[model samples]
Target: MIRTATPDDVPLIHAMVRDLAEYEKALDEARATEEQLREALFGERPAAFGHIAQDDDSGEVVGFALWFLNFSTWRGVHGIYLEDLYVRPEARGGGHGKALLRELARICVERGYERLEWSVLDWNEPSINFYKSLGALPQDEWTVYRLTDGALAGLGAAVE
Candidate 1:
């Protein structure tokens, strides 16, 4: 079963995020704290939303997806930018990942969103193949860029 996450699920969400980072070989980079997640997910103006996938029989949350809305100026529509989607190692091959994605797709269709998108590490062939199997196309022509940490701080200081 899959359902929208609530504030009470912040701890689980944080743990799952760490698990995902570990799987991606970047555990040290998972620096988000539970308080940050709570504020971001359930603050006065939420910055993102989350979904949890549970095992019906065991009633345990085995996976989760965290996403936020983004505007596509060219398309003149909104889209969902999935930041993380993960299923526990023991829960693989159980359709949980696909179910979470399908739920996101359904939300897009219901809300008239233009697209649902996320980035995957190039080395993760298994996830790439899974996404392809769902008919998701890769935007290979576009390059992703980042401006964070010191660079981000530098830009803010320059403006000041």
Candidate 2:
């Protein structure tokens, strides 16, 4: 069973986020709090959306996917930028990942979104192959860039 997440799902979602961080070798940077997750997903203006997959028999959540909308100037249509997709190791290989991705695509088609995009770590060959099997291509022409902490804080000052 897959469905949109609600405020009550925060703790489970946070745990999944931490698990994904650990898997990606960034456990030290996984400092998200319950409050942050609640506000980001359930506030008056949601910053992102989340969906959970549960075990039908046990009624326990086994995986989740989180994403935000992004504008694509080239495509002239909004796209879903998947931020996280996770399934507990025990729950993997049961088609949960593909199911979650297919759900995202369904949402996109419903909303008339032109694209869906996400990034997987270079070392995660299984994920890369899975995505490729689904016909998702890597945007090799464009490189991603980021600035955190002090650099991000200085953006306003630098502009002025």
Task: Please report the candidate that would top lDDT against the real structure.
Answer: 1
- Model 1: worst 10 consecutive residues (lDDT sum): 151-160
Model 2 / residue 3 / CA error / Å:
0.4
Pairs with backbone N, CA or C atoms under 3 Å apart (clashes), candidate 1: none
Model 2's alpha-carbon lDDT is 0.93
TM-score, cand. 1: 0.96
lDDT over C-alpha atoms for residue 60 of model 1:
96
Candidate 1 structure lDDT: 0.95
Cα lDDT tens digits for candidate 1, 20-121? 999999998889999999999999999999999999899999999999999999999999999999999999889999999999999999999989999999
Global Cα RMSD, each model: 1.2, 1.2
- Mark the regions of model 2 whose C-alpha exceeds 4 Å error after superposition: none
Candidate 1 regions with alpha-carbon error over 4 angstroms = none
